[model samples]
Target: MSATPSRYCHLIDEGEVFLERCRRILGEIQAAEDDLSAMTTSPRGRLRVGLAFAAGLPLPVISAFMERYPEIQLDLDFTDRMVDVIDEGFDVVIRGSELKDSRLMSRPLGPYRSCLVASPVYLQNRGIPAKPADLLTHSCLHYRWQNSGKLYQWPFKKQQAIQAGESLPVTMVCSNVEALIYLAQAGRGIACVPDFAVKDSLADGRLDKVLTNSLIGGSTFHVVWPSSRQMAPKVRAFVDFAVENFSKGLVS
Candidate 1:
């Protein structure tokens, strides 16, 4: 082959880059076509999902989803810490906190409220807390936030005197809401938790509400996914299913 002049050497490098870019574009087009075909045929793919630790308590939703979509494989990650939907490659994430990321598209699952609860035995032994101030004297089962490493503040609507920095009489601290519920049921201490989590215990006479008039905390859950021009079929199916089921008083 004839030796290329120095002036034309840069063109060779640019040509190589142009060819690489063309290959990349073709690969992307093929992937997009595959996605479209899958959508039109059936929602079948590996779906990576992240759920808040407490959100996993609704086993029926998970069970029903799996039963309905046997072709789709589910990869679930349960954690209390915030997960990045894009960076972590999660197709969907269900969380009890407010949606702050503008890059995510979200659908409201439902609202859930936190309340003070203790075992019937515990209430008998320590006496029912008639007011929010009474918690200072009672053994409190505290939930420490996984992300911030701080205790969850029990929101008492009537007790403005209870400052944020004020310490409660903490007996046991856990990051998992289910553990705290179990501890409360075992008559360890009074716990503040979401109402949906302790529904069975309350129905079975294992736990009872405390300070119902004063203590109040609630938040809506959201199903979030990365924003895109078009959502994958599997992701869309899960999001719609969650919204439909959860809206029927599942979380509330």
Candidate 2:
């Protein structure tokens, strides 16, 4: 049968369109397979993590992870500085990130409760603070943020709004929370550090919690990673493990 010239051209155009669609579908299929493999397959690579100095709480669990994946190596950076995860080449950062960037992915660990604590000796010598307002007369160990150049104030319960009338000044200050805890333990002053940081001391009577009614609202920790079309297997593995175990009770 002799086909009209227009009909023949239309048939050829349709065939071309169908072939292009097939190519696109195949490409999508391949991408899906790659993503599946990335998640299901055993990952072997180095993971660089930036964290707060209080990594000890969650880090203990990482020892088990290492035993499971002997091929994966870890590089840790324990500093309070707000790390540039993407520019600094950190595979992941576990910190109290604000999570404002749209170009990043995050998983919340959990909220931390700030505690007003002092060594037993400090309390014995200085006398325990009867109320949040009493902190004005007592010495305070301050936390100075390196990135912001701001001293953290002791956050008290909103119910005691009168007690938290203003941010009190500190006599002693440092950038390290651990240092502040150590100084507090040495009876230098009462330190307002993350509850996670002082759990052991509080349990063993090294540190005593004062002003129990006026607890500070601490920030939530998150596992943040750079957003990409193809997430690395190593990054996924660590993020999942952290969210499952380190997200809660590491401090509680």
Candidate 3:
């Protein structure tokens, strides 16, 4: 029996209807995918960070960033000992000075100055040393790097030349910055440390700056992360926020 033309027309109409439904479903799927992509790229995750104790100046920067990106969870590990950010599983790291590592990318957050300081009680008890050479006579607090085999040398400026040869008479040597700073605050001995760490104490008369004109060396604070983290939304947001706040001197 020959097929009717109406039957053929009906089959063609049904095929058209099926194609139209498929196109509609595909459009809906595409729209759903776009929505998912937007959400996936959004900054929302727990961000682990590492920072030196001396780099606490960036706390306000973190606070400001949190205000803008409420979805990111922040975990800050503040310590003086260095850690491999990538290997240690840290998303970001705030270092007190420029990093020389070729594996990581860093942004200049700001510069900081270190000062030789002592408590007034200690200085009063032991006369203030007028020169870097005189620090040899004074009981000086020494900061030891766990990674560096040697004790930190007291770097000083003399005349037009940078002199780092003058090693202080070390009465105390410790790895913890907080402990050493506390001892300095308690009038144990003279200490050379970041100015920001003792800014409050210096202002409140608990600590006094010694050899204000001489500094170890000027170093810039940096926000460092693994180069692989560039595309991470949380890391990107944090880095941008840190640069904005720190560079403007708004946070620190």
Candidate 4:
């Protein structure tokens, strides 16, 4: 084969780059021109959503939504592990962790609340505490953060002052909310848990809330999704639904 001239090779390279630039410019123009009315007009399509189970199950709300919008199919993933939204093609995720991915858009649902609880049996044997400082002497159950390898921080307002991230001794450490509460119920130790996790326990007389005044601050729940030029109708619907319900005191 004959060797191509250097000038022809340079021209070929420049031409390829020029075409690429043109493609990017056209893509931006198309994105800018994308119509949002398409999303507002109709809601139809499969919406893949994920949520942190430890945060609390949203089954009741999601069930109600299914009845309301039968046209939009919902695929729910209830998990503790953080799933990659863009790579996994999830339309939305309910997360308590601060969103680090700038590519994703987030809407704050509300803040979470932490409560200190122990089983009725455990408190009877171990004796009840009068303040947050007394908790240091009692056996406690912990939720070990998967990402940090450390037990999740417990916050408190103590001694007429705010003392957050106060660490205490623990008898057992695990990530599961049910198992943690079960341990507390079995008279193992005091457990610092989300209020939503132990609603049944509180009602059934299995666990009793301790240090109600010594409240712990928690992460805010957020509905996040990959940001795009034109929002999909299903994604928009769910966002709106979540915001409306949360605003009306559906979930605390």
Better of 2 and 4 by lDDT: 2
Model 3: lDDT to the true structure = 0.78
Candidate with best lDDT: 1
- Sorted on TM-score, highest at the top, how do the candidates line up? 2, 1, 4, 3
Tell me the lDDT of candidate 2. Answer: 0.82
Best by TM-score: 2
- Candidate 1 residue pairs in clash (backbone atoms < 3 Å): none
TM-score of each: 0.80, 0.85, 0.72, 0.74
lDDT of each residue in 84-162, candidate 3, tens digit only: 8778998889887766788899999887777788999999999987777777788889888877746776566647222
What root-mean-square deviation over C-alphas does model 1 reach?
6.5
Q: Which residue pairs show collisions in model 2?
A: none
Query: Candidate 3: how many backbone clashes?
Result: 0
lDDT of 4 at 29: 79
Candidate 4, superposed: residue stretches over 4 Å from native: 1-33, 157-167, 246-252
lDDT of each: 0.84, 0.82, 0.78, 0.80
RMSD of each: 6.5, 3.1, 9.6, 6.9
Better model by lDDT, 2 or 3?
Answer: 2
The true-versus-predicted C-alpha distance at residue 211 of model 1, in Å, is: 0.9
- lDDT, residue 216, candidate 3: 51
